[model samples]
Target chain A: MGHNGKMIRKKDLTFLQKSYIPEILKGMRQTIAEMFKPKFTFRYPEERFRPNPSFRGRPVLVQENEVERCVACGLCSRVCPALAIEVQASETELEKERYPIKFEINMVRCIFCGFCEEVCPEEAIVMSNEYELVFSSQEEALFGKDRLLKSAEELKPRLEFLRLNR
Target chain B: MQSLLLISALKFVAFVAVVLLTVIMLVYAERRVSAFIQNRLGPNRVGPWGLLQAIVDVVKLLLKEDVVPRNAYKPVHDLAPIISIAVALSTFAIIPFGNTINVYGHEVKLMIADVNVGILYLLSITSLGVYGVTLAGWSSNNKYSLLGGLRSSAQMISYELSMGLSIIGVLMVSGTLRLDQIVLQQTKYLWGWMPAWNFLLQPVAFITFVVAAFAETNRLPFDLPEAEPELVGGYHTEYSGLKFGLFFLAEYANMITAGAVITTLFLGGWHLPFAENLGLSPLMLSLLQVLTFCVKMFFVMMFFIVVRWTIPRFRYDQLMNIGWKLMLPLTLVNVLVTGLVLLLIQ
Candidate 1:
């Protein structure tokens, strides 16, 4: 049978395969072997999985030198498919100009698609390796700038990976 | 008569307690074995290596809210799980766990009841287990539950024919229906080397019986009744809280019963080869035999769990074909061959 658009015919099985006994035995043997193999389970709470630099986790505002790198650019908010990010621009005394007076990311609505991070021209809203996002109430899930901001040192690996890849 | 009654009562209590405890541990073992087969760590949080997991589960079940559907038949829904568990637990009564032991001046058998028609009693009681599932399904007023119950009952009936036929070979070989006598017969060695286990003599019957037993217990490769992808939860879909817990307990209990049956019928019960030559006292020997039976039962249970993780559930039509088309005829052939051989030898 051709791999193209042609109709594929079923291959004739060997006597052993047709009988199914050999295949069954082989399967059983494989499973028994797997029983002795090392388990890949990570015991949560006691142990955590450390994601690589390429891994996208929770979105965070990169804080550098006692100030956020974001100039209140609404690009991240506009690109967010979930409509999770909300920003209010305000005048700033800094040379770069406007800053977000109030910025909020509804952790509940955020789909972790990294669209906000991708659209941010300022490189401020990058994904941080903080995957454990638990909130008891709807209000608690609405992350303000206080919770959303992370120091550049904390997000260095992801930022480095992004810069190298881009 | 009073003494005999008292002894029987004591034996019954002991037997039930042992079985219930084993069933609890067997649940934990099933989970752990399944996890190991899939290369994952199972429950290890409740107690030491999760030894107290069963206790925690029982407590959780007892505390959970019991939900009964408005449209469901209340009495039948309530009665179904009780029947399921009762039948499962009752099957152990006729299974001879060990030989007779002398204590002080009296002789005591390890089994609860030494019934003359032990195998017949076992088969009949096990057959009654289908009622529990069927009633549970019919009373639940849910299509999934009804379908599951119907499938389970139909599967049990189909496989049961093969199972019974397979056992006919064992019956013919042993020449006795009494379980203790069957075990005694198995104690004889073939040419002073290999144990005369029925598994050696009736390999085809053993395979068919094992396949049938797997179907009867509703384990994987034959678990079409409770196929989670199709039937949701089969018969116990509508049951919740301890009522659902009862069904879970009943399934594990049935597995243990199946394991015990397989061990008794084919693996030579508790008769260990060359056990007599150890020169141990009668009491010690009886204890050793009981230990042997438990060991064999444990391995059988492990095999059951392993098979569950190894094999995927069969399609409904394939399950039916295997039960009727394949296993039935094969067992019939096994019976005929065994009968012919026995006649020739005589």
Candidate 2:
């Protein structure tokens, strides 16, 4: 029985060696076929290749009226996962309203969760489809009131009507 | 003297044209090949099938800012890539791309210089390629750069031994160190069917050589030097714009060099499969031979791309073990076996 076991072991070794060469050849064949496989790179400038509508992009503040939607509620600041949003409010003449005097959203801190958009009661903030937000410095990443207001104005036309009514 | 000077100048210009054109087209091919493998469309928006993308890329690279890192060892860091690019361009001087052709009533050899020790010269210069990688890594002074340089040094030294050993088997059978002579020796066939390609006769040596060449070129599976995720840019993380472009250029140039060397040594450079002794005119045969050499190189290059996409990269330890344990021992045994066979036949 020991002798038979030794014979079986030797046969197994032979089989293993024989199997490797053909398996390796099979791998080579697969690689040759992959030479003709389709590539993954997308042409950026032309053919736009727009992402799906559900594709999450850079977040921007949506101004519902000529007034800022933040209303200094600070709920966005509270719910912010990255603590990106900051709101400094003061009383205003329009219906005893509180408006953010100094509003800033640090884009580097943004997780693009749309959480701030969901958390807003006034429906003032919504993230638009403008995903191209590349910057060379940290300062540029911190969008201040002026920059955010300008971006909000640019996105004002695209905001939904129900949110506008709110 | 003036006419002689003019002739030599023209030859130089012609070599430059071919090398530059090849680099551009090869870049395009690499992009297209990679795109195909990843299931995406390559640069098709430019000219036909993105042919002009390479030209546009070159122009853009040239016009881009050449930023030198403030912390870098400036002179050495700057010169390292230049040395690499120069060496890559210069190595072509010894490679014979085609047969003699007449231009302006002057007969010129296709090669720049066919030295007696052409193979050794090729090896020596090719080995120096590691220095560029090492210096770029070290000079950058970043931890990632330092690691990249250190890995490259170890990797190049380990693989060079195996690469050298692989060629020894071919040298023993061919009985020459000269590349031109090696090609001449490969012209004859062993039987009516076999094409005298060294790959058939010494499969072990061919495999070792090809694998070692992959390592030598710092290609994938052996591309630990620039392993991106782990090392960021690896040796060249600090370099930006055209300075970075030089390292990129050197990588492709080395790929081309490796392809050419493999073609000349094993695949029967420029010789047709089974068409030897047909009594064709020397000029006509030479032309056909050049075309054959190109086809072989192209096929080998495609093999490089395929392996790159198909195989996952080797871990550093795994790469080291394969080089020293598997490839080195196997190559040495191959060399010994080939030498013994040659001795017995003689």
Candidate 3:
């Protein structure tokens, strides 16, 4: 446009486009039509979202036959990017021989990255579907085995999903 | 004289109450409409379909801290929003909501004030609305606010000319300055079929006037004054709590005034098509006429809200170009043609 009033535009707008009123009316028509269409919003309190099996929510230790599948190898703690998991190994009479006696996952620091679940040698830790993790204090957010462990039957879909994919 | 005073007081109370309520409702409608356009549900939790959201929002604003900048000129900052809301509300005084209605054997005009020079009052008062924005910007000692104030004043000046010229065509067609008389003139049927609305009679004037109205109201496609990306809330950058709430109410109030003005001038104010021939009583007809006026204003207000979300803000240069180059000349031509046509018809 700087070439001494010579036109540099590749395409010239039509009279209607230059006037812009018709184009504006057209846009208004589109918007008004869109108003009658369905809205994509969840009424959060009354309605809830159900995530898929592939969805990684909160991380929990898988429990099999009333015992945790974790071998207390500290691989999940080592792999946790947020440093949310803490594990203390103690010899047990069970066949797994070693289990986490002081197993805790800080809900506040857990970023839901699923890295800890991926790094576990024994499919012991897996992301669960229970995503509504509300904590009043930092101490309250440090989830112990009581809160972090889920039964194998309860997490069957995610386990099945892991089996099918991996 | 006592009865006259009583009726006037009643009308004043009713008008102010309706305007304020409509302002709150307009805010809710804007949010809901914008959400609908974008495929999202907005503010449905406040009340049934979020009907009470705007009222709740006003309460929230009232409860918030009224903050003032340490270096700010405090007096003008306080007075600016008052000026804005006052100007926005006062323009409605001359707008005739309906024809004269008989109440207890007394003829009561449905307007707050029946000023003879209604159009002039409207033009002068609406232009003064810029002072509120300008003073708010200037008093804040914020550069963005200052720029916003400057842009709004310039924008108002440029568009106000076209807005006035567009109305001149309507004035020539109707040949009266009293808004009620103008509305009365529009009640006639042209060629015994078409209702002689100013819009139908002078199409060009209607288009130019509506566009000018959009710009004057500081809505989108001309909201360069408060362009959020560039000016950060524009003149209201420093205002918070109830102070900011007043500006918000003023914006929506200005919108309703514009809608009412547009309806009164161009849309055949309160002249419901063929409603007179329905064998209704005069009192019933007057009531219907009032309702008709409200429905027309509501539709126009809807147009304003929909247009806001439909169009993007104009650049400062583009705004100036349109104001000076396009709308000004267009309205001038429309005025000339209207005058010539009137002369020929006479």
Candidate 4:
């Protein structure tokens, strides 16, 4: 006979299995064993998960030499599906001629899709590992330029991961 | 007469308080056990190891707004939860937790009522519990509630027959409907080693009764009435706040009652092996016996929780088939065989 596609066969149950008691006992045994197994739950606020380089948390503007790398191209704002990011560009004397006078990301509106980071031409806005975002009021959730800026040293691992992977 | 009344009233108050406390603990245990079974730590935030979680839950429930549906039958809606809770609490009156204890130079029976027809009273009161569910469903005036109510009543009625019949084997052997007497009868041993509990003597009846108890309590494998996927909260769909809390408390209370009844009937209630030979004082012995009963009931409650997490819910048709075809016939056979064996021995 010629070999065809993989044929899956259902294993036949013996008298004990057919009776349901054995299977039920086996399941109960498994569950009781699982009860003693080590749990994977993190205490959350008190305990935090350290995300790897590829992990996309809040999008942040990389600050190198106490100056933001962003030229305020407005690419991130255009690519943001949620329209959460808003950038107002102004003239600057630095090598990057244009700088954001006001750059704000609405944390509540952000879906954390990493589109802003992916579309940033300057590699300025990159996803950091800081996932803890708590806001009691609407105004508090709006991340201004001061809140959005991160020291390049802090986001080195993510930048390295991006460089290596991309 | 005055003393008797006072004692009875005191017993009632004590029993109610104890039952409410047990219900709270049982809720906590259910969450913890279920979490453990699923490989998760449950509710360890409220107090040390989440001991105060139940209290927090009670507070939350109390603080919630009591929402009644606009088109609901207001009287029945209000009455249903009260009726459910009342029936659940009332059934505990007949369960003998321990033998008599001497308190203040007077002998007091551990149970609230030592009624001769204890088991019969239990069966009748449990049957009345169906009314609460049915009324809740009907009064909600929702299709899901109505269906849930109908399913619950049907399931209860079907399982109650087997549950009642299964006990006939035990009743015949023990020769009494009094729960305390049944426990007393279970104190004997067979072949000088094995305890002659009804569970060992009539295994078939025991299995049937346990299954029936699960169905009666609306636990998993028999929780068709409140099938969350299909019924969307089932009969208590329209219930909110304290009314929903009553239903929740009533369910746990019923579970505790089931555990107590099972302990009284099949397990040796308050009877520890070789305890009589221990030579302890009468007060100490009675206390130990009460402790033994509580331990047995606690294990039963744990078994209920474990089995709930272990098994999947049965489909409606499968539930009916098992109740009527499988459990009913097996119980009948058990009764017949028990009667035959008794006759032969005589």
lDDT of candidate 4 vs native?
0.92
Which is the leading candidate under DockQ?
A: 3
Q: Please name the candidate that would achieve the greatest TM-score relative to the true structure.
A: 3
Candidate 1 residue-wise lDDT, A129-166, digit = tens = 88998899999999999998899998999999999987
Residue-level lDDT tens digits of model 2 in B92-211: 777766656665676766677768888888888988988898999888989999899899999999999999999988888788887878887787768666667787778899989998
Tens digit of per-residue lDDT, candidate 4, span A82-111:
999999999999988999999999999999
Ranking by TM-score: 3, 4, 1, 2
Calculate each model's fnat, 2 decimals: 0.75, 0.61, 0.92, 0.81
Expressed as tens digits, the lDDT of each residue in A13-132 for candidate 2 is 566454344545677677667657654455676546555434456666655456666788989899998999888989998873788898899999999897877778876677666677
Ranked candidates, highest DockQ first:
3, 4, 1, 2
Cα lDDT for residue B199, candidate 2: 79
**Candidate 3 docking classification:** medium
Where is model 4 chain B poorest over a 10-residue stretch in terms of lDDT?
Answer: B199-208
DockQ of each: 0.60, 0.31, 0.78, 0.68
Q: lDDT score, residue B101, model 3?
A: 90
Native-to-model Cα distance after best TM-score fit, residue A13 in candidate 2, in Å: 9.4
Q: Supply the TM-score of chain A against the true chain A for every candidate structure.
A: 0.86, 0.63, 0.86, 0.86
Off by over 4 Å in 2: A1-25, A34-166, B1-8, B100-107, B274-282
Candidate 2 lDDT score at position A52: 44
